[model samples]
Target: MSWSIKNWRRNQILQREGIPDYIWQKLISMRCLKGLNPDELMRLRECATLFLHDKQINGAHELEITDEMRASIALQACILILNLDLDYYRNWVEIIVYPGEFILDYDYADEFGVVHHIHRIAAGEAWSAGPVILSWQDTIHTATRSGHNVVIHEFAHKIDMLHEGANGCPELHANMSAYTWHEVFSQAYAQFCHQVDKRQETIIDPYAAESPAEFFAVLSEVFFELPLITQQHFPSVYEQLALFYRQDPAQRWR
Candidate 1:
């Protein structure tokens, strides 16, 4: 029974790999794929196609991972890495999915070694060397509204973790200056925290206040979803993300 199930899964995946262009074209037409021009969008589609072929996603809660569903998730996730090498996501293999939001459990010891248990209910999460988890409801909410991009946000976190810990800094390209990145991001992050503390209304989401890591993840959502605001408010950070992601989204999204 196990061998038969594995053989069937292999066949299904091979057939899905060469997914047609029009399917991706329709995806690009999605409001969420905004901020990228025609050429960039096409590149996103190609990279997404390859990504769909390469990665494995398992559906839990009796929900099956369909071709359309996987394609939709892959399209947005890999677009961030399209300009860079696929090796960025190479360390991770599987993606886990549930029909809806799920709960996570973990136990930790503080600096004092006082053991504590933590439980979190979240729509998505990225593991350092493990699977990316998602909720089907949130996945379908892509590009609609509510200022969320679970896949992009989680994968951005993965990108951040690629270098070391998720301290909001990802590995940079040859052209990016490490000092300049730190200066701009650190200053902006402090100001954002200050603004949030003062209760100042800001265009970017308030969730960005959680921490530098949250700021990077939240800003990544806006960097693609609401590029104009990101560029207008944090031009330097916007430029840095553009360079890091290797795509000028502000121009296209606007």
Candidate 2:
């Protein structure tokens, strides 16, 4: 769609089905959303309203969906795209919320072409060009915790997927340097992996050591939730993230 038409439709959605005041107030109070000025908050609200209008959020395993639940999810998802456009989440339309950690059963081919069936409990999962699946229990529990947000983690994957399937590099803006992004993230990921291998206590999640893609997603969680930790530990990576997301969360957090 053209930018003008999209903007018109978004305005209509904001006018016709804006978020309730109480829910918006509650969302703004979230730690992850702290330090947004009035104008940013307004833009976030409009983006969230458009998000709720465009996406389908449904409960699984007989879990009932409520307005508060929907708003909570939408608000966090919108935060990732607050400085950018909501088009970052384009081509996805569903968010399935389970009551808690749900089982993931799937088959995957290993690097050697060996197919394996795996089953495990998962708090959240995001598919390329598909829905975002989450455990609502974990979502609420982690939302308030510093450096832990399942919603942001999964949505960050979606953003990373927009480039070339989440290899720790999203599509950079024209002004941003791809070489610098790789140099910074590759070093940070390696160092972080070494820390994890040594079982060293760290502020960021160890799960990030799993892969470069995971490093990006998990670092994204830290970037927004505990910007200071990200900046302190990986200053260069933090700068790249600030440029990519187009927001200085550390500044906002301060």
Worst 10 residues of 1 by lDDT: 10-19
User: Model 1: runs farther than 4 Å from truth?
Assistant: 1-16, 35-38, 109-116
lDDT of 2 by residue, 1-254 (tens): 69999779867888999999987777688777989999999998888888999899999999999998999999898888998988899998999999999999999786699999979999999998899999999899975566899999999999999997879999999989999999999999999999999999977989999899999999999898899888998899999999999999999878
- Tens-place lDDT digits, model 1, residues 1-254: 99999668756654666567666656766555766767876667667766777789999889988877888888878878878967788777899999999998989675599999979898898888889999989878866765678888999998998897688999889889999999999999999999999999977778889989889999898887777878998999999999999877767764
Clashing pairs in 1: 35-253
Candidate 2 global Cα RMSD:
1.7
Worst 10 residues of 2 by lDDT: 138-147
Please list the C-alpha lDDT of all candidates, in the order they appear.
0.83, 0.91
Itemize residue pairs with steric clashes in candidate 2.
none
